[model samples]
Target: MNGASLATGQRSLGDPSVTFPLWPPQLRGCPETSTAEIAYPVEVDYAYEDVDTALFAQAPGPDLARWAPLLPPLHAPTLGEGGTPLLELDGLPGVYLKDESRNPTWSHKDRLNRVTVSAAVGAGAPGVVVASSGNHGASAAAYAARAGLPAIVLASAEAPPAVQSFVRAYGAKVLTMPAEDRWPLMRRIKVLTMPAEDRWPLMRRIVDRFGYHPVSNLTVTHTGHPFGAEGYKTIAYELFAQLGRVPAAVFTPTGYAEMLYGVWKGFAELRRLGVAETAPPMYACEPAVGAPHARALATGTPAAIVELGPTGAYGIACTVGGHRGVRAVRDSGGEAVPVTDDELRAAQELLARQGLWQELSGAAGLAGYRRLGREFDGPVVCVGTSSGFKDLETGRERVRLLEDVDVDVSLDDLLRATDA
Candidate 1:
């Protein structure tokens, strides 16, 4: 970890007064907010006044470590995450896409895993555990592998098969389970009482009390790793530097809204430090099948849960609302926009046509922007969360709805096959 890190300690987002030690990174979410069906997460705080304002004079680094003064203690090695390109779309006027698929493991989750896995190494844990749909688990496994720690990922059996394979490639044990069962299994060890074969050998190794760091949520609602979202602060820093000014609006693909809040926090820090006069409007883009954050905003609740419907944009199709998300949307004067699968598909196709193939859900920000249909006072940045390759239908299957057919070895046949 950098000695220049200005991190003071952890504070519950629910109650800023409730603070905890910065060391031995908080694996469990805030206890103060724990309730029957909701719980708020904790966020790391830093001595911003102590940060050298001159550091911003130079361009940001390719690694997140350069901004260490504003982030949590990074105890894990870097996987070359962060510093993704801010591409200005040719046809979209001032609209830019902060394409996060450029990160290691090809998703924004790499930013988070880099911080969360480091917490395990800092806490002296033997390994890390996480429950993910696809991008999260794959990124966690890669980071844990880099940290030389064993990782057990509880992944949904329904997630893209390619992503499950990606997790296993990092030497992590993948325990495929129902989407609903993944979180419960990650939080409790009662399932270990099942027969040896039924419970599986890997399940016995998961004893959180025995010093395994959980990189995911451990509460009734979602309160992921304390330091995870901190890693995402780099996105805001990068955007500010890339645009040479704060954007008027930022549309983020919100699963738990961890990344969205992280980005908002970064901009907020800048505003507090007098670097910027205002923070951008933060939009939480969710799958239309279930926009719990939107429901929470409408109901005036800290968080709310929703019944999920079938949608291909499963990456951000979370059933439960996260407080971090509500805070980001509310604090930034942003709206929670839900886009249908058709909207997502349109955005995905358009990006692909523009030579940027993004995951179905990764196009949510652009989809949401189009759905909102408003002009911004300044530049608008729509976040692209991951690669289209991570979609349920593989890259080869996406443009092809039928089985492959062999064409005859003639110029005429080739032309006929492609309808040239």
Candidate 2:
């Protein structure tokens, strides 16, 4: 593999005093700090150089590893995860959709898993572990399989049947359990586990003993995976190349807002390198049930945990907000908009009418844009995060069979029956 110009170390978001090496992926909570709830987001430094602006016009390949200069060393195999299409709606002028459902796993999580599972391979771990509601597990399992590693998926019993089946089909050992029980067992097993609350300390222990790499949050508040978000940066690169410039705004369906942060970072990098004059504003759209990012922005905190109520947009219903998300919103002068399930459903139907079948949660960005009811100075992009097939409602329709036509029916009779 061609080596990346990865810098020596990383700095913490909560405290600059807490720094660590880029290798052996660091935790989200700072050990030197007293408050574990304060998310310590680590940033990987790279030796970025100014490249020719004309290079942006080149088409990006399906594999994100082709952009290795901007990413960490990757060891996992690719399944054509990136290079999703940017499409425009017929009726919605100055609005484009970044169709993430075109990915291998039919979700944006494929980008994250591509990099995170590679961390497991880089660490020489025997297997990978993840605690997910649905899509994350399915993507992680597929990537782990591609890396020739065993995958253990600890998913919520409430996860959709289709998502569960996807994980199992990827040859990952799946355990359906309550959300609270997933982390403890994963840490004990010393596998590379996903982010969760009440498990950071134990994860630190497992990392120390078994050298298991973690690619998700480790703090009470979400800080996000350092390298995993790098995969999402490709979306911005593709958009910039496709649009010939940055759009005025980008609306994303937000959970922990990893993709939101990563997209913003990519645009910022382009501006820094003189590829673009400015970065677009980022809008984070979340289910109104929780919306921790909205709460944090309103309360003016780096991170916040909010009590969640039930909502149909489960994919974006995160209880905690990440500091990276807050930074992205603030730096870009953007807003976090809370959307209702009703609005998301309407957006889903609208997209479906346009021949784009997206998950309800994946349509949150469109819902937010409609809720805003304002026009942008330039083109706006809404990221459709996943396929409609991943939603639980996908296969629930009942098909009614018409009475069978007689084999001996004449052509006139068939025509008469059709006319009737």
Candidate 3:
């Protein structure tokens, strides 16, 4: 009864057509400026709602027309990008697979990229630059393309072969640099790249603001697009509609920590709005080879600083920890778990048995869950972040094929073998 009504065709809360506020109140707090080197303005906010308001009742995208007046003037009606499936695993008891691979880019990174690109467009950046080894780069590239903005992806040549192909497939300028130099170069580009004053930043914006085409800013990071994370909130909403109760835990594979943050934030908001009775503990799963976020959580450090090492799960091979990672684990009283290559492979096989084909990195959440399942009770959802196709770059699946094989298939032979 409290949901935003699409039938009225009236724009209200958080809609550009309305007038109160642009961002949801939760994102209104200033971003932690504790570190001067990477200080960036916090651009998201939310409204004050009671714990029982049932936040899911309001579907942002479909309700955009109703809430348009309450958001930024530049904000427009959005696609329903957040609603996704939470499929149960046949072989694993109490385990569910949140298939984020179904997103626009075939990965959970779409949740972050959609919002991040919107930020670039809103800020009027000429171009966007990103330092990524896999999913993030592809997500950024595709969204940049969708916005009709120029994008530059600074990736390590050592990245998995499939990810390299994904970056190029999106028409993003793939700059191959040494692994050590990628991040630094991304920072340099951020400082040097700026759009012309007249640039529109996106095709839609160009048509809305001026007739001139816009350049894409290569500096956009973080899913600060208020409406973008709105896509992610759908995960929680669907969970509620499906289970009729909240889950006990939600495990996510971490890189930029956007997926974890998005799900955690969604449940938290739902709990706050009285849509859900409780929030699930959000667990972050990382590859052991470079799990700075996990180490940081264990050490009680604000952010962990360590050198990233190579791992088969390239998507989550992150070193530096993000602020959202800290918030995600802390808010839900959750823990960060690290899994090894062997564990990821095993989990991938387990998922295969359940008829789910996930990339090695995508299976890391299940791997961590398997390792820590004993400690957690009740229903748990592990995010399958991407499809196996993204693992093509490693070239680790070389197999020898036999041109011909001598074999017999007959009922008598099968009976004899069984008897033997």
Q: Best candidate per TM-score, number?
A: 1
Rank order (by lDDT, best first): 1, 2, 3
lDDT of 2 by residue, 118-208 (tens): 8788878877766676778888889988988887666555678788788889898766533356556654653232333434454444455
- Name the weakest run of 10 consecutive residues (lDDT summed) in model 1: 190-199
Estimated TM-score per prediction?
Answer: 0.89, 0.88, 0.72
Error of 3 at 36 (Å): 5.0
lDDT of each: 0.83, 0.80, 0.60
The Cα RMSD of model 1 versus the native structure comes to 4.7
User: Which residue segments of model 3 deviate by more than 4 Å?
Assistant: 1-32, 36-43, 49-80, 178-231, 375-377, 392-396, 399-420
lDDT of each residue in 6-79, candidate 1, tens digit only: 88898988888899889856555787766777787989988887887766655755667878788777778999
Model 3 TM: 0.72
Error at 409, model 3, angstroms? 5.8
Q: How does model 3 fare in lDDT?
A: 0.60
Give the per-residue lDDT digits (tens) of candidate 3, residues 303-398: 565676667787777655655666778879888898899999999988878777788999988998898865556778888988887874445755
